[model samples]
Target: MAISKLRCLGLVVMVTAQMVSAETLSPAQAPVAALDAAEPTVAAIAPQVDAEQWVRQTTSNLSSVRYINQLAALYLANGYAPLWQDSLATTALEEQLQLLALSGVSADFSRRYAQLAHLKQSNDWRQYDLLATDTLLAYMSYLEGLPEYGRGWLFGAGIDPSLPLPSSQGLNHLNSAIETGQLHAFIAALKPQDRRYTQLQRAIDALAQHSQASWPGFYQPGYIRLGTRLQQPEALITRLEQLGDLTPYQAAQLRTSNVRIYNIDLANAMKRFQERHGLKVDGVIGPQTRYWLMMPVQERIRILALNAQRLRLWPADFPSMLVVNIPAYDMSLWLDNKHVLDSKVIVGRPSRPTPLMSSTVASVVFNPYWNVPNSIMRKDILPKARYDRGYLYRNGFRVIRSWDSSEQIPIHTIDWRLVNAKAFPYRLRQQPGEKNALGRFKFNIPNNNAIYLHDTPAKSLFNKTTRAFSSGCIRVEHADDLARILLTDSGVSPQRVDELKARTNTRTVGLSNQVKVHLIYQTAWVDEDGQVNFRNDVYSYDQINPMSQKEEKFTFLFSGENPY
Candidate 1:
């Protein structure tokens, strides 16, 4: 079985190599081929270095060739090779892989890898390569089908019969497909005057009038919907058939319509997209979905390539836990692979963007005191406190009258308002209760941000799609459910939470056992069926592609290491 798999992978590699060599504009084959006429030949450079000496120097500092090879193998297995094909993407992979290689995969590597390893272990490179190959193949298949969904467009020139695809006019393809007789082809299928065709014509015309309109890339305000990427009607119909649940009319609307999506409708489409991507569906397009969508196709191809390069990164045996997608701005509490609760959350704003880290929820704080951050205190609260003595009290803050670092002593009682900005010596701490900023419960995950996932008094923010409202903390909507889960896990009976909520005195609730909480950023996610879904990078991070600027520094090193 293993041999067969290896042979199949070898065949795939050979076919891929041939296709890559034949189909793509090679690194060596520039569009301006004549420009390389003066460049040095391979023979001219051959005698400049000693291979044995170079290998020895490169190997001396590294303790493990096997380790380097494993990392390289793992990256290769994950299918990062597709990234190499796109001239625009190769440098990003090279730079990131170099940084990671330099830093070494942190404890995160172990946390994520342990779970994958448990599923299976490879005893040899051949086995690793086979598994990686399978992983890559699966990812490729998923990606190839990605364009069929509205997440992206796959561009090819002309109607190439050799390839099993129709040509795309690109996502920003201008000019009308106003082939004279083609109007009937699109309109005949609609209800005699289904306004869809007329609206579609109007949209097409608008698109044409604005043909010179900027292709603000993917994240722009007036971007295309996730559906219309399909240039052919039949392909759209076929994809909808596979999607299931979608009505024929709705699918038709998607195929024929030329509508620009807003945050709300985009949020809805994003949820349906999320459901297809294996995430907890809440109708809000969060970070993970955005990461998945906006991820460079090359990056995805690399991820797939690397999966087959080594032993499994995830161990089959693992603890029951919660996986919070930092990018998706969502959380999923799981026990034995079953979901306990899921909800939407407001992560840090772009300026104070949330960090991507993982930690165990060692404790749950009930009616926890909000110790304001220095930045917030100095910038927002202190100014208000100085301007209005009642501001602190109005916002439910209690000023610690006075305290020395070594001794606690009552100082002169200066009216909070009357005191000059420099005279304030007290720290501000809010009492945890109903009126508290942190609502009732906050899941504690230790980190530098002093940030935790918690409930909020301001529930109205959840209704908005763009909730960059928080200073730098995550606020949850279904916080109560999360609290109950933590309490139950911590050995506090469900009945006890009801008991605690009624109490007027402030107190804290600690979980019985530690639950791992991951504050990760994943803009891209795959559905249960392995369909990749995307989200809007509300912060516009996608616009920073290296290719966008010529002055950017870049390098491409051909190290035989894993690239993930």
Candidate 2:
């Protein structure tokens, strides 16, 4: 039901257009001999191999019949592709079965294989087929290096390589799974204990450009170009491997492309690759482009693996959501799963990193009040306030002294700086309007840290990609647009959102429905086209030695718990 919320939002799907099901270590139970006992598969195409004998000999345990049969159905449905059917004579499917036998190397594969074996035996043939198809679809979605959401496959629709594949109307199911919420359930149903449980999804998410076996860096012409670069396929793979992003399938795909360099197929493939990776679909490979292609796959994988862990930090459920991506310096507002608005943002500088956090928009302080942070007060404002007592008033700040023991009399007011030197008690709040630090439309999310995204009087910061200028809080470029979107359901119209912009008088607007806000940081992320994008690890996380981005170990503050 929680997942159903996403489906209500529009979804995009594309089946290879769907994805590749690669086998690995097998299941715990031995291979099923009963499948061989059942009707034998028709004599094999190409090199003839006994399907029944292979099943019986390969699968020793009858309990694994379910998984073995599931594999068979997947092979049969896909026309018995050699990869899925275990065509390699020497290393048969049984290898995976044995690994599942207990300790050893291919534990992830073996477990998946065993699960397949169980499904075949336990469920009806139709049910078995459906389950296998779903699993295979998910696996293929992973293999084609599709994101858990399949953005690549969707973008590939207009791309030349994917042009060969079938196209459909409406949302590309594969690409928009996450946006639509379908992936949440599929991901949740998976056995969390499995090693590949997180890895597969991480790989898919990382399948974007940064993880792809291509050039590295942004493809800006003068700065770093990919044109005129004579890159070897293996070299690209090697580089991606170093980056922790090269998957066996991606490596293989690149190698195959290398065999016929500069050809139309390769050109189209490159174009599709470029398109899926968030590059211009120009069929040329330049230096910056090449650099992106060469980013170590492992690095991209690590980023995605880390990001998946971050997604877990989101509220288990929220009526409405406003999530900010620190790495991209971007923020998105969503009602249900539908996107309301997205904008560029400026977060904190690296030394004063914006702390990852979450809270509800308890109140919307329109026009707003600005309580100067202590550091700014001491370093910037205090000096000015000391030089000129009227400085605070000039900047729209009002100094207030509260009555404590005696209700009638006001506490004695001293020169602001001298009062501070003598440890006087007073809170200075800036009046709402143009000069207010909070600008207009401050969505107040109650938390220990007084942090919230708001508008800024200075608009130039939005143009920079690396906008880490704030002191821990976030500043949005289109604050009013975001505010209107957040309050739309409460009967606040776009007209009102626009009107409030011109009418700058200070006023607070209470929200009928409190919105949820999440401040997140992911160094590597995927775009709508499934292109994997990476930000300069502003925190220098990539440079830190001995730091592993294991999804289970990396903790983030989600709701009230640490959902690592």
Candidate 3:
């Protein structure tokens, strides 16, 4: 319960004079004697202001005190006592802040921590304390994306991500921990112990070893087929060898060849590279492949670091849950630490990108109806209905007055072209049949986005590596197999579930123990072999945090260039 204050944040925060006082530290608590310089301490500031009232009001209204970061408010409220007074906590805080850059926290964060070493020399313990806490809070905000499984890093949407945790009771628990003097312990436990974090950490360590290694310059070949002699085959060989696409033995043989050629083995390796990088895996070096080939090793480390920062929010206690990695286009079902199922999934296309969120599938609906959303109906369906006379009927679609009403309206009565899209009163419902959009299974996860995982009649989309076809909902490929597993988990026998499925009629079964669903958008991960797998940032989030090119960005810790 050390970090319990944030383990869960409650909506209701109870503050008393004692709690407020505890949050506010006085100058007596500062280790001024430990400081080499005669810096101004908290005792010098407390006599000037009504500490209790100021703190109470500041903590009470986060909006009005937006200018005063939580750290500053706490320091002022505490009579300017430094929170990082303990050398152990101080050292740990500073190191963590500096290391945040390597974790791909953000360029803005890098700039802040870069100054922490130099800030306290002239500043009051209060200013140093404020900057320290601000940096710490920013790093912890990565946990805000704990729900997205990858949302915590890369500068939060300019809002305090730490507030509004799971519940107020959890928040109170964290507060209690703080009141009990477990704040240092709380800061200690801030970094997560996720397995992915471990892998990415290893990856970065490996990349850091190669960070100074020279990579070949950018390549832009028109196109290269197998056996084609290339102008920069030597450079390409160096790039492939450096990228691990070609082994030493392979490169040695290729290097010995008098004529540098795009051979079969190299092309195959390029295909593997293309597949891993979310490019067209045609085994031909083209513009996209050449672009990735030219990417710097430091950039690779930066990408891995950013992903590591985000994935650090992945809980150590990963319970039985379903995870859909949106960018990777895959869904995984985990049960008791084992991967139960992994199925290809077609996610929302770019035009209607899948919303990242977390929810619970409390029940499974079989042979479900596809209630056309107004947005889809107006944007997608209306255009077709006016052009194709039998488009609606052929697709098992029927017009209905409202969502709740089962009574079907005469589809022929409504004029497709004359209807005003903004005021379209009719609802389009797809009947439960072979042609139904919701093929035969729908995992219901209620959310404001009005999206759910369901089966689709279009199976061909799953064949494509990039399966971003549906408007906004998820279309699971092996939905029937998933349904069987879920139904059995819900206490229904497999045989019984099969019997229900054979009936070919609409039905729903309650999932006795609701399963957790996390829709994540990770672009990099480590496989079982500890190989770093990278993917295209379909949504371009990976480009958000571009680490500065300065070498000092990675080297300020023990250099003592600026020590607190």
Best by lDDT: 3
Candidate 1 worst ten-residue window by lDDT: 150-159
Q: What is candidate 3's lDDT per residue for 1-564, written digit by digit as tens?
A: 111211111111112322324334433232223222223221223523354454443244222222244544455544444455555666767655655565444545666666666555544344455456556555555454344334423422322223332344433543554556666777667656567776877777776776787776746458889878778777887787777778888888888874477788789889878877877889988877877888888888777777766665444366788999888999999777778999999887766667666788888888887788777787778788888869998998999988788788898888877877668888888889899888999888867667789998888888887788777788999999889888787799988888888877789888987788888777888877766688767666665543332331232112111000
Full candidate order by TM-score, most accurate first: 3, 2, 1
lDDT of 1: 0.43
228-323: candidate 1 lDDT, tens digit per residue: 332333432333333332356765665566433332433465566556555556654346654444444334332322221111211223366776
Model 1, C-alpha of 512: deviation from truth (Å): 2.6
Tens-digit lDDT string for candidate 2 (1-564): 111211111111111212112122121121222222223222212113433343343344433233344345434433332222211311222332322222111233345456656644553232233333333343332323322212211111111111112122111443344344354333334223444324435454444544344544333243222333433445534544434444567657667666423444345555655644445567676764565665555555544544443343445356578888776788888787677788988887765567666677766657876766555555556667777877776778765543222122222255555656335355456778777777776777777656777888878878664688877778888987777776676677788767776676766676777877887666555555434555656655433232222321222222211000
Model 3: colliding residue pairs: 4-174, 5-174, 8-170, 8-171, 9-167, 10-167, 10-168, 24-78, 25-78, 142-152
Cα lDDT, model 3, residue 182: 65
Residue 259 error, candidate 3, Å: 5.9
lDDT of each: 0.43, 0.49, 0.66
Off by over 4 Å in 3: 1-95, 102-107, 116-134, 137-186, 257-259, 280-282, 545-564
- Tell me the spans in candidate 2 whose CA falls farther than 4 Å from its real position: 1-294, 315-319, 383-394, 402-427, 493-505, 540-564
RMSD of each: 19.7, 16.4, 11.9
